[model samples]
Target: MSRERRLTAGAVAVLLVALLGVAVVPGVLADPSADGPVRPGRVSIAESPAIAPEEVDGATATLRLHTRIGHAGNPTDNVSVRFRAYDAESGLLTAERTVELEELTGDRSVPVNATIEVPREGGYVIETVVFRDGRVVDRDRTRVSGLAALGTEVHFTESEAVPPLSVSVASVDEEANRTTLTVAASLTNGGESASDRLRVEVVLRQAESNIVAARQSTTVSGIGPGRTADATVEVTVPSDYNYYVDAAVYRDGVLVDTARSVANLDPTETISANMTTREVEFEVSDFAGDDGSQEERATEAAARTETATATPGFGPAVAVAALAGAALLARRRTRQ
Candidate 1:
């Protein structure tokens, strides 16, 4: 052959060899593998609307996971799901099986099932990540709590430590046009661990009926082992009449205990309709103080003076006369 013809033939031969090598290569057209988190649109991860414990204990809990994987437009398949469980503080727990998978749906999706075991826990959070077409498509989390050991067993079971919580009219400050009452109650933790953020509620009920009159709540975060939390919460009752009050304690939104207080009405014989004013004495500790220190002399003097001035200063004679007049008025009203 001529030099030009030989050169053309060699070039064609090289081109043909390159094409043959490319054709002989392994299956490179296969789709990429799915892994990691699921991002919206890129892929869809459908997790159990709810995560729950089949059974729970200090050592382990079986958590059931329901999930789906898919893509928006294309029918996608072979999605990968990663599952994990952690304590309340978010420490990861080891799972017997870490991976789950589902086939692409007709609309491009699949379903995956997985079970997780919780080791030991104060609280546990379950997380799921769905991957579709080799990319993360969706993510979700669920929370579950373990039993905490508290001094008192209020929620775990019913017991007397669950003292009756109550509210009542302890006294009436006619001079101040206000009524004060003691909010007394007790709570015991009935758990293996201490409870935090314990809340107590006192409900003032309408006397002679079960209707709630007024509501008040108090909370103390720490209640330790075999311990009782006590307090005197006072509410100002505008009226001198008696009313029913109910009280209860709650832990983590659960009512653990409750109790009631005797309603102490104002002394009607001492309170007269004609006398528009009266005096009231509050405990020295009633005022807010860090160390329960007594109020300043000046403050006490001012409070007492204000109380004295509000009521008539009728000596023994006037008191006797007023008593007689009140008795007669009472008799007449009863007769009417």
Candidate 2:
């Protein structure tokens, strides 16, 4: 071949290789199966102004999605975004909706916009999937909280007379997701009708942010009247928690008494000051013997009389008792 022909062929080969590098390499890099750059086309989701359920009167939740898809190659139309809602059990309760982009210019990015409605109030998992060529390229999920029925007051039958209770939190266990709390409440009534349900409300507050993060309530059954009930409540607390607890005792929709406690969430093994556990003991009351109350009065009276008698002349009696005890000790020692 002539030298000029050979130079033309060399130029053609170089141009072909340059086109392959620009076109074929991008396809291989964008392929999800190839361990290529994980470019599921970038994703961004935003929700419009919707009132949170706890703060609003009407129970409605609306959200808008503004998604941007980037690095998608040419002929990238028919790429759709789909949304689905699932229950706590992962059951598919609703059908999925897909929104298509207007059109991809010869550029490498596409933008799709969508709006979705939240129908019910409960725990829900929201998911967004990006589809290309009838297959899911990438997906993302987020949890929505405080979605339970709002304005629905949980009332206690025996809680009418009792005010809102206060709670003191003692400790929080992050690994186990449990908060240990001490609750104390006063019950009024002379032992006739007692409070059956005692539930303490624990509010978790954020320390640095100084905001109320979460609230949970737990109940203990069967508390008697004219007495104070002291107990511990174990509840689930979210991560990054600063919280305290409050308690209320109720009977037949009437609140009778309340209390509060404080809690901390440091998870360190602690050695208690008490080396051994001690059992609590109480004086048994004799209801059958009418002298039970009288005996108590007589015991108190004798104690006071002894205290008064020992004031001045009682010193001599103590000395005599000490001498007698010493004499007995000396006699025993001699015998030994």
Candidate 3:
């Protein structure tokens, strides 16, 4: 080729790489949480959203799609969340629900679960959109299947109360470094009739050692539709030690539901059950295998990129640079 043609070709390749780099460098460097990339003025998802139904009844069932949202800025305000359910195969809208939120604080991520109803068959794509000031800031979607297999589950389930079941350390008495805890399990009946008698068991374990500190079980009364009931029990445990309050509900000799709470009495070492998992951005999931965390995968990708860039003759940029250099040298040789 002529020197002008060779020189022009090299310039074009260089320009292409520069443009591609401009489009990609920001995503590579941005700090992303489990849900998505956290940016100022942009509300990001915290982690993988879950679509679950406590029970399926008749032709349709009620389900919840939980999305955790947060931001890097000083907390978010005037947020409204819209939940949309689309048919997995047909891509048609099945159901939609919107819930108004007071605020999404920056200190911690908030789980905004949308209640939606759809036919108790086929798969669905559940999407959650976060809107601030009537404009969408962030959104996430995930596929859910096995709806046809979720047979008629127990009608009675835990109430909507946060941490449906909890154990609180009672300050009534303290002797020999021991304390009493009142464990309460909340139950709500969403069925058409009264619920069946169920059993709630509250077990406490040492936070660090996981030793059984105290355990008790109580019977929760059958509740009427839209009514809530609590089964309360008292247990004693060693003071100044953290404990995990594990509450489980059972009916007809079958375990139905469970909830967990943390009672951190150790003032020096407090903990929580809400340590949300931070996932790598743009992770792929098949809903079957546990191939490891998204964050780990992202880190591995970064490591590979760094290795390629540092080593010789590995990355595309290096190969492209070599090509451009050869073209330029060839053109210069023709001129000489």
Candidate 4:
């Protein structure tokens, strides 16, 4: 063949290989096989897509959709999932998102998650499409109604340790030796729904040592959209010691957010939140003579002993048990 004809023929052969999905390696077609993330396979939808209301803002509703894409053959190229929301009445596209998919290895199925935000007034038709190498392989559609009735989740957060203690002061009494602090962590619910019974865990630590002075959990109620509430919990600790108040916000028993703030009561000492916290020390000297503190003091004197990181030489045990042991030892010595 002439040189010009040979060049044309070579170009045509390369085009044919690409069309057949064969990888040309080292100037040779290697066993008609594909390579890399761009290869296509039998991409199929294995189950019906699932849709649920995620959140609601002032005038819009957010919905989450989940799809499981399965492959029937060998490993394919990198895939993608496209979620589209269309107005049910006008058939106009409202929102769309494409998520890049991870390549399937030994796992035959990949779960894809997507969310769409639309006006909360009407119905919507959600469509899910799977694409491989820029080509649509599979598509599915589902319908959603009663957007107005979709309940939005109220997100609660604790931003600071004691942000302008909101409630009445009678719940906490400030004493000279030890004071009770009602940590009012500012929680904001930006979602469209109102929620109650949100839980917050507040821990008070001595600034000089990581020793946990008190830990308490309390519920914040009446949280509404764009409204701020307080996660208040009372923690009574030694008065002179500066304290770091740490708060953790949890939903359904799962930790969702955390925050810290300082309550520097001692002018001579400095304390900050977010530092590591440690266990308790048992001794009457630690909590002696404080009015109405006997119950909390006794709880600290429980059997479970912990090494006091801050208070060196503070023995681990109930203060009563320690005193009893000492008395027994003194009697034995006297008898001897």
Candidate 5:
């Protein structure tokens, strides 16, 4: 072959090798998954229209959250932005707002504002969530501090006789094993002003020793004046002791009032001494005396009080004994 023809054949071979290299190597020229140099859908939260690190309690403040969404490749549509403020310690939601946009062709900045009341002086968390097509695309959170300050306060005179907040142990249900107690508590806002972020706590404690056995808490939103709310809590406790159900009410993180009710679970009439076992056998007569007088029974019940290691089997046995004793006592009274 002539030199020029040979050179032409060499050039064709080099062109074929270059085409093969492009097919074998990925991302050599451009990324197929990405629309351009940047991602098609992007979201970010901005720290502008800044919130004060500390604010006065019981005051309302305007909170603004700024968000930026970018649609680089395809037109992102139907986007949502949400702002939520909550108590960082209690995890109670204080305020919330949402903004919706139809469609976005370029980068867009969306600003949302919410009026939040700082009920109590404490640390709080502000959160922002961005959603697209019902899916969360971005989330951000910041913290703020609430400071106590002198504000317009209302004082009720004793002569005025405003209804006072009250808490009561409505009912307590013992499990078959007696190891668990489900307590229903009722709270009433008797005062003239409304209460927000009210918390109710149920505690199971030994009557004589005042040792706490179990406790749980529940929260309620703003309770209007003269309104009532109910909450239930289940507590796991040690068995074979007389306990008292104590219900405590708090308004704006301050203790208001507390109520106590008796829970007699002692197998006093039948079991004279402490029994160290998974289960103890007792008779109904152990709780009552021969006279069966109300005062005598109370005295005997108090004298027989003893503390023993609680077991799963012991709770059911004690519960059974207590029920049987109550039924027998009622029957004897009827006979008289």
Candidate 6:
């Protein structure tokens, strides 16, 4: 044979061997039966199961699994299902249970049920795991919320002597520029039952126009009977309006009590124009005495000199000096 023809034949033989290796070698190497019995077809979570709340301890979660087996595969027997409950906040396992299923065949849906106990009232999670033999085949998870029943009656009380639940605005302070109002309130629970969730809201509105100025809210948990809780909220309002501060209390999404107080703002202190920059400055101490209280005097002076001026011995120079001294003392007191 010629040298070129032999080389071409050898190249063709190498090309055929490469093609066969690509197609056949991987299948032979990947076949699990070459080592042992092949693993059965995969399983998956099929449907989202329903979760129902049980009265006191916890909730019940139902799960469904879909098993897909190949036509030539053996029946999957003695598969394990594990249900675990975890606290959503802390992610700690709170409850767990396991069940075993009978032999599963091609394209079948299996239903499993488990009850999870929640330690406290909050968010919780349920996880389902399907195991074939000792290996995990599929897993699924869902979340649930637990809430306690409102056992005790809740009401609003205006009188301090009355109990169960009461809310009152202790004070309303308005800044001199009428930009913000600070509301402070006290909440007392005199009822026999404690509230796990409590919400307090403070709203500011113009008394004359009934226009809402600002609203702020805060929350507290575990307010026991006969215990008192305090909340403060700062509300922004238009400058130069007589506003009313309303403090309200809520339990379990229901409004229980509300108290109202008035905030008298000076018309001159109202902000007339909108400020665009955040660095705008104002005198904080200017509103310190804006509570409308009369200025206190340091000392009291008698007008004995008025009557003494009628006496013949009283001299003009002495009277003038006494008047000037009194004026000086008054000026000094004003500064103090």
The candidate maximizing TM-score is 4
lDDT of 4 by residue, 313-335 (tens): 55656677889999999999999
Choose 4 or 5, whichever is better by lDDT. 4
TM-score versus the correct structure, for each prediction:
0.33, 0.31, 0.36, 0.39, 0.30, 0.35
Of the two candidates 2 and 6, the one with more favorable lDDT, higher being better, is 6
| Deviation from truth (RMSD, Å), model 6 | 15.3
| Candidate 2 residue-wise lDDT at 72 | 40
Query: Model 1 over residues 44-152: C-alpha lDDT tens digits?
Result: 5544535655654434557776666555743455666777766667575656355645444345545667777655436776677776656666777777664232123
Number of clashes in model 3? Answer: 3
Candidate that beats the other on TM-score, 4 or 6, i.e. the better one: 4
TM-score between candidate 2 and the true structure: 0.31
Order by TM-score, highest first = 4, 3, 6, 1, 2, 5
* lDDT (tens digit, per residue) of candidate 2 on 81-178: 78765665556654356887654444454555555565445556667777776777677775564443232233222355553333455676544344
| Count of backbone clashes, every candidate in sequence | 38, 35, 3, 0, 3, 0
Q: Write the per-residue lDDT of candidate 6 for residues 209-313, one digit (tens) a residue.
A: 555667789886676787766666666555555556677776555455667666656444332122121232333343232334222211111245555565786
Per-residue lDDT of model 5, residues 28-102, tens digit only: 667765655433456555443356423333344444444454444455776777778888889999887778876
If both were scored by lDDT, which would come out higher, candidate 2 or candidate 4?
4
| Candidate 1 residue spans exceeding 4 A from truth | 1-163, 166-171, 209-212, 266-336
Where does candidate 4 have its weakest 10-residue lDDT segment? Answer: 164-173
Give me the runs in candidate 5 sitting further than 4 Å from their true place: 1-40, 46-49, 52-62, 66-71, 108-110, 147-336
Best-to-worst lDDT order: 3, 4, 6, 1, 5, 2
Cα RMSD for candidate 2?
18.5
Residue 164 displacement in candidate 3 (angstroms): 0.9
Compared with the true structure, what per-residue lDDT tens digits does model 3 show for residues 262-314? 88776666767754322222212211233455567668878999987896657
**Pairs with steric clashes in candidate 5:** 269-286, 269-287, 270-286
